[model samples]
Target: MGRRRTVHKKLPAHMHRKGNSYYFVQMVDGRRSWVPLGNDLAIARLKWAELTNIGDAEVEDITFAVAVARYRRDALPAKAAKTQEEYDRALDRLLAVFGKMPLDLIIPQYVRKYLDERKAKVAGNREKAVLSTVFNHAREWGYTKAANPCAGVKGNTETGRLRYIEDQELLAVLDHACRPLRDAMEIAYYTGQRPSDVLKLKRTDIREGTLFFRQKKTGTALRFAIDGPLFDVLLRITTDPIQIPAGAVRSLYLIQNEEGQQLGYRALNYRFNKACKAAGIPDFQFRDIRGKAGTDTEDVTGLGHAQRLLGHKNRKMTEHYIKERLGYRVAPTPKLLIKQKKRA
Candidate 1:
């Protein structure tokens, strides 16, 4: 004979029935605070959910706006300037939509809806990243203990940056680019380094025949050989007689504004964009030059040999750049199948 089945009854959290009334167990000051929740199990369940989700000692009843404000005030200043700026842009959109929403209620589904409404993929992704950072900071600062809403919601497919600078476009843009942007673009092109890393270049970073520095994002120590074009740009900037500020040191940076100081990433981008527009080559950007280097290097030396040029520790990341330029279609054709008849 089969063994007798043992059964366990399911109960709504913190709920118990007595006669026609239902009571909920609410924790208060290490004591049970029995709250009346009426007789209907559905009503009791709703009441239980409401009470249980409320903030505990570690978590606070903080709104998303207040939490975000705290993060903006206390944490963002300690981050890299580039990172702060990007997060600031992302926050601009988030605050407009979820400023008053409770931090604990903003789940993955809510964030997905926010992402869908964004027209640009990159914009949506940036906002999602910023939100995650906000929640992480909130948890540490005792704002809320809810899981980050941005989790499990994947970012949109990024539109690959395909604009590469050719010889003619480079010449035209260089002819019109301001002094700061000219040096910035040329360095990025010759060395295949990020504009952020290139803009942070100090005059002291050059040694022997290579430019050596720790990459800002990855912390990878990179040493790129100074090609002929890079040497030419270096020579011009090194020799340029710019008026140094009252307290600023001369020759401190590889690229500088009119006042001899390190160029900022934001300032470089604004000026570079204007230069591209003026040169009738508005499509080209500073990053496109970096991509051009990757494409050119991959063609000449193959993917493995081009690894050092981009300063990536992993070859997979280096290959991503090369693959973008290859223009290879990813969609495969479906295999045709012939129908077969079966007989008994």
Candidate 2:
């Protein structure tokens, strides 16, 4: 009287074979959904058994996949949208390799092997960090008794981005940029804010002759007075507002397209890249504008000034950010006093 299984006849109840992968059909939020149990039949069988008996089992019967699923349900939503996207990607790789493996069976050697074998070294480092968090959660959930395997593993070495945009290069890029792109570029440079932060700016953020910013990544709140060149740019944007389409809500964002919609990350990036190419500037990114602001501020005043301007918590970070983009500047040694002493 029930649906008959003609395929994967050896598979247990509720297990369905599709393509090279196996899925377990279960009720999720009152709807039947297919949860991937991986391609290996042995591993899929183990996962299915664990999933079915999860409510009546001890920690020893739990799999890493169960822990990952619980984490996704309980913790993943708390992260920022961009952060959630990143974690989702990292978790996919981790789940593929460790999903059906028992939590206690994961060890330092296995963690290191995964890191070593991953092609994207930097991305592997990020995924390993996510894995470490998962392990921590697994311990709390009583899914694992073993310590986190990723604790002792070292990530691959990473080099900081050091490209600094010169004044002429910025001007050249500006010449090739469209109105919206030019506005975005000037705001990024003058405000010395991240590209995302710049695009998030709303007209309401300007209050009492100050532009307020609350950095999403660091939770750093900063306010810059509306004066000098910054005032000029803001005035230009206000006087030449983008034309809004009929029946569409006007965008509140400082940088918006002709349709009066907020400029998306992809659109801004594409325009920026095209402008850079037209300017004949290679290896230049929009983020480099913030670095130029730091370097220029340090040059005009001091490192402390740059640090404050960039909202860095410490001088070391600010120093590293600015570095010697245009190479080091050295003062000539003062005239020696020994010659006058010898003449005397």
Candidate 3:
């Protein structure tokens, strides 16, 4: 007679029950394993169906490794490269923390605990945002039915402590900086453009005494009319040509050092901060100089004009720059403010 069949023989490829509530599925290869399906019976059933349809004649024998390979091949390519990178990183972190916990056993509370632990180690709202996005993607791809644990997690609020140099501080810092850093800082301060845009600036971008280029971050075309002081600075740095790898150098915004290499934004930032410290100007961030410059331009050109120069998506952001730098007060006009009637 044939040997009596055991329960383990029926569900052979590492199946486990969780609290009499759900099923967990894993595929193991000796010691290594993966939880390919977790949480709900419906989702587990669907994944099983998918596995069988894919020619896994014995769905009961499907391994976690196979499920992981299939999921990555089918689901990962659908996401953007940057997004995929973030998801991969998050998964790495998850695996480090949970290390092959059965998928069905990963309750919402387990995820919440993981997040709380990570929150202490990861320093920034960005990490939290990335985690939230990954969990959302996992749910959308049918990896889990549980709502994203990160949904209600609060992100750290960025406190805006404007580290803007006043006119006198700017003058002092610039006077002490080396020529390359000074020029770069001046352009950032004068134009209110991002460091990336300022670094990529070229001579050809300047036409009719105005610097014109589409901002790299926002793709908004900005035009800043060059004036006497800015022109003087440009004239001081205009010298020896830089050989381009592909095409001819088109712009003169990035002045090379004596070594003839372009000044990277990182180097520029470090040198700029050093100059600020030497000048005894505390809290003078590179970006604050841009705000100061924008505030100055708002008087020359209207706030709307300054808004475009700074490449702000809207006037509201531009207004914040103006208010912080110029101390421009916004109170309701007498015409709009309600006044008390004369006392009887």
- Could you tell me the TM-score of candidate 1? 0.69
lDDT of 2 by residue, 1-344 (tens): 54898776545668898999999997789999999999965567567767776445577778887787667656776778788778878887898899899988999999899988999989999999999998998888777779999988888778777788779999999999988899999998888889999999999999999999998878899999999999999998887787777887887898998788889888999999999999999778999999999899888888998888788999998988887575556787897756754565
Clashes of 3: 7
lDDT of 3 by residue, 1-344 (tens): 43444643322234444454324344466553444555643345345546545334243433323333344445655665555665555544554554344333445566556556654544435555544554555455555565665666565446655655567988999888987787788778767877777877777877887878787756798776778777766666665344445544444456554455667767888888888899998678777777777788887778998887788989999888687655764576658466679899
TM per prediction: 0.69, 0.81, 0.60
Backbone steric clashes in candidate 2, count: 0
Candidate 1's error at 100, in angstroms?
2.4
User: Relative to the unseen true structure, what is the C-alpha lDDT of residue 131 in candidate 1, on a scale of 0 to 100?
Assistant: 88
Best by TM-score: 2
What TM-score should be assigned to candidate 3? 0.60
User: Model 3 segments beyond 4 Å from truth?
Assistant: 1-122, 139-142, 207-209, 239-253, 330-344
lDDT by residue (72-151, candidate 1, tens digit) is 55677677767877776687678788877877888999889988888987889888988888888877877767888887
RMSD of each: 18.6, 7.5, 13.0
Whole-model Cα lDDT of every candidate shown, in order: 0.76, 0.85, 0.62
Residue 318 Cα positional deviation in candidate 1, in Å, after optimal superposition: 1.5
Model 1: colliding residue pairs: none
